[model samples]
Target: MPNATATPPAFRYQGWSLFSLLAALVLLMTVMILIINPDLTEGVRSAIRATARSSFVLFLLAFTASAFAVLVPSPLSKSLVRERRFIGLAFAFSHLIHAVLIYWYGQLNTEFWPGRTALGNVPGTVGYVFVLLLALTSFKSTTRLIGATAWKRLHTTGMWVLAAIFAYSNFKRIPMSDWYVLPFGLICAATAIRLMGKLAQANKRQSLQRVA
Candidate 1:
């Protein structure tokens, strides 16, 4: 008998896969940015000192944009969600950079990256831990081993962790007037709304069944 299960085309190593293309573009962009700017190092660089903070701020903005881009409801939204695993991995790498920048800032200012106290490290550490877990479980092997139900549960938890870290990071980086924050915050709200709508629809269907 022939094998019953068919592999998803998305999982196959297609030539020029979206994940590969995005990864290449990001790598090229980073190289270009460094070459154009020079002195991209974290220390002993005047340009670094001038732009480091805003770079992180802008990173947060871009991160939020990428997340919203995936969530935006449209024709491509389903494909975006289908490819979320890859997109999420990319987001995790960006978050990792943001994490390093925070640690580096702590080293530089002696009071900024993490505050002056031991407690200051808590939030940054929490953020790092979240990103680390995200990175580790993001592997396709790990997802396959965990099975879909388990993986979905894990992803739900990851989402909450992600939301928490986003809030913590933004709160720590407050006093900036970035209009993007409103939309970023809305992404979380939208998730909640979507879930509630799903539940309502399910409940409505059940009530009709009972009446029939």
Candidate 2:
């Protein structure tokens, strides 16, 4: 029997707990959608084939979610800092999905996976590179072997690279890109707050030393 005063394991793993609940909800919705309209999913896929809009929406969602996984106040951030392998993997998955959706759109009308260039093709290449770097750092062995200091440097640089990828992608599409401002804004605001906090702490320590 568990100790009466002991907090449950779920409480301690807050990030996983939240992810589990959200995953359950997504599964339930999938089941409901499957049952209610069996062909709806395929029908939508068919529609997305000719229209790049669908992929754009999914790419945006993926970009935003992955960005939030970094910026949002969550146990996931703590897990990442602690080098939790699974959480890093989850972030990689989200970023990969975003990359795939963008790639889907890019390839929907052309043959530019590893070759060929077009007006809209550059951002896709840059975006994939960002995702690849992120995935590389996400591996447990890679992070552990590199150590936290190096990992931080790599991840911080990756964030800027990732941001540039999304920003460039959004701007390349002009009016369609305007929607990206939301996630980009969220990331920027979170970064500013974090920097401000650090500055405040430094000032506090300096004041304390002066008083002493």
lDDT of 1 by residue, 21-127 (tens): 65555555544555676454543233332233333333333234324433453434434445666666655655544455445555656655343577766765775
Which 10 successive residues of model 2 have the least lDDT summed? 49-58
Q: Which candidate is the best by lDDT?
A: 1
Alpha-carbon deviation at 29 in model 1, angstroms: 4.0
In Å, residue 164's CA in model 2 sits off its true spot by: 2.5
Model 2 lDDT per residue over 1-212, tens place: 77986333322444555345433443444345345655654433333321233223323333343334344535544333343333434444444444444455455545434455475566656656755776687766887988999988876676556556655554444566676676555445545654564566577689999999
Regions more than 4 Å wrong, model 1:
1-16, 36-74, 99-116, 178-180, 192-212
By summed lDDT, the worst window of 10 consecutive residues in model 1 runs over 44-53
User: lDDT for each of the candidates?
Assistant: 0.53, 0.50
